[model samples]
Target: MGKALIAGVMRWQNTLDLTMSPGNVVAKPLEHVIAANDANKFIAYNNIPPDIPKIKTKSNSKANKNKC
Candidate 1:
């Protein structure tokens, strides 16, 4: 795992136990960086270049009007 993937204290105290979501701290550390993406966000926006025109539909044609 990359340095960014590992953060905070190596030891666990009550303060380090952030977030109520339960998880294991004993996970084996990886030696290499891993690649990941937001699957839902990727599928929704499709990584399309912003300059490309989108097909305007009834529901989305005015989606950007409020930006102005």
Candidate 2:
């Protein structure tokens, strides 16, 4: 999966004579490669919600709970 992504970026860079910058090559063409591979269909099937779940505790919280 990762190799395909890098290959896609390199192909795009070569075709357009652009430098190897992430911003220019990563998002858009990676999206195209994903779509072309039908990954979006699987993603749609999962239907994951667009919210980050809040962590109930942090490292400091664990230390407090341990209470020496």
Give the Cα lDDT of each candidate.
0.37, 0.42
Score every model by TM-score.
0.20, 0.17
Clashing pairs in 1: 1-30
- Consecutive 10-residue window with the lowest summed lDDT within model 1: 26-35
Local error of candidate 1 at 25, Å?
Answer: 13
Going through the candidates in order, what is the number of backbone clashes in each? 1, 0
CA lDDT for candidate 1:
0.37
Query: Tens digit of lDDT per residue, candidate 1, span 42-68?
Result: 222554544468776675554546545
- Candidate 2: list runs displaced more than 4 Å: 1-23, 32-63
Instruction: Give the Å error, residue 38, model 2.
Output: 13
lDDT of 2 at 2: 30
Best by lDDT: 2
